[model samples]
Target: MTGPRIALFAEGGDWHAARLGESFAARGAALVRLSLDRAMLATGTETGVELPGFDDGLPDAVLVKTVAAGSFEAITLRLGILHALRDLGVPVWNDARAIERCVDKAATSFHLARAGLPTPATWTTEDREAACRIVARECGQGPLVLKPLFGSQGRGLLLVERPEDLPPPEATGGVHYLQRLVRSPAGLFEDYRLFVVAGRVVAAMARRGATWITNVKQGGEPLPFTPDARMTRLAVAAAGAVGADYCGVDLIRDEAGRALVLEVNSMPAWAGLQSVTPVDIAAAIADGLLAALPQRRQLAAAGG
Candidate 1:
């Protein structure tokens, strides 16, 4: 008998996809690659959905590896497909709702604050004048980090130390997303990325950077680090705040040594985290997804 078939929503043959394929194969499951853009909603079909490679029926589960960047309508259509699969009894890891919360920095911060989780103070506004006023008011105390509301990989970030540093609305995609810059103690540039699976911190690493930005993609060095009790608790709580099945929770400490969550990524890349840890991160995620299948199927059967 054949084992379960899993769908991996991603683009191209990336390194992450390869690792996940090998891990799922080791566990006797077949991982089929599918792009969200190509999936469609066919009402007259047997399954009412036209997902590539699943013509006869739906897969046992789905792992959301990536949601490719697209126009507003295109992205919404892609997410709608994920929502449809979930409503039709297929388990989608980090489902559309979770993805939305994490993709929008403002939403993520709101959820974190609502859950009483510790995160840096943040603000978002579409009005250029309002953003300038905010920068003017806040810069006296400390610098503000301006970021694109819908961006990742530490791209398009600027340090606003003065009101003049605030750019025109056109330069910021018509919305200004700002956060109070978390200053490192004694000019030390460091942060932590903790990988959470099934509500547990499986692996973690300390990213030491040459500048204030500590993302590995921006030349930060990843070093193995075992999180302490407080860090583990905070990371786990941060993931829960956004309702992610699995995530990479970025954390940092203030001068007073209090840990704060920097960001919660619903579909976080783990190559850097994988390099320093021997826990086989991909296998852990696969195991987590497989372990939840029974319970998810039960809920679906019960019309949940």
Candidate 2:
């Protein structure tokens, strides 16, 4: 008998997809690679959503590995496919709503703050004048970090020491997302990346670099580190704040030793974390996704 089929949404030649495929196979499941751009909505089909290679029916579950960069309409359509799948009773790991909240840094910050979580002071606006005022007022305390609202991997970051340092709106995708820069004591550049799965911190690493940006993709070195109880609690809370089934919670400490959440990534990459840890990150994620399957949950509830 064939095992449950899982649809993995990722681009071609993705290393993470390959790892997940292997992990799922080890657990008596088949992982079929699919692209979100190719997912279609058809009225006359058995499943209103027409995913490539799932001609007879929808996959047992959908795992969102990556959502490629595209125009606003294109991205919306891609997310719409995830939404459609969930409405069809197919489990979508980290579903559309969670993706949206984490993709937009402003939204993530809002949710974190609303939950009373300790996060960096942030302000996002489209009005250049208001942004300038925020910069002028906040810069006196320290430098403000200008980040692209819809970006990741430590890209497109700038330290704004003055209002004049603010770029034109056209250069910033028509929005200014600024946060007060949080630095470690004595100019140390380091932060923690905690991998949370099933409401627990399974593994973690310390990213250290010469500059303020400590992302592994940006030349930071990843080192194995066990998270303390406070870090574990903060990371789990950050993930819950954004409603993610699994996530990578970025945490850093201020000079006064208060832990602050830097960001919560819904669709985070774990290659660097995997390299330093022996927890089999990919298998953990596959386990988390499969355990959340609707059929599995129903069976468990029925004592199967």
Clashing residue pairs, backbone N/CA/C < 3 A, model 1: none
Candidate 2 per-residue lDDT over residues 1-304, each given as its tens digit: 8888999999999999999999999999999998899999888977689999898899998888899989999998999989888777777877899999999999999999999999999999999999999999989999999999988999999999999999999989999999999998767899999999878888999999989999999999999999889999999999999988899999998998888999999999999999899999889988888777866457545654
Clash totals, every prediction: 0, 0
Residue-level lDDT of model 1, residues 1-304, one tens digit each, is 9999999998998899999999999999999998888899889987778888987789999999999988999999999988998999999998998999999999999999999988899989998888889988888889999999988888888999987888788888899999999987778899999999999999999999999988899889999999899999999998899989999999998988889998999999999989999999999999999999999999999999
Question: Which model scores highest in TM-score?
Answer: 1
The lDDT values for all models are 0.92, 0.92
Candidate 1, residue 74: Cα displacement in angstroms equals 0.9
TM-score for candidate 2, residues paired by index: 0.95
In model 2, how many backbone clashes occur?
0
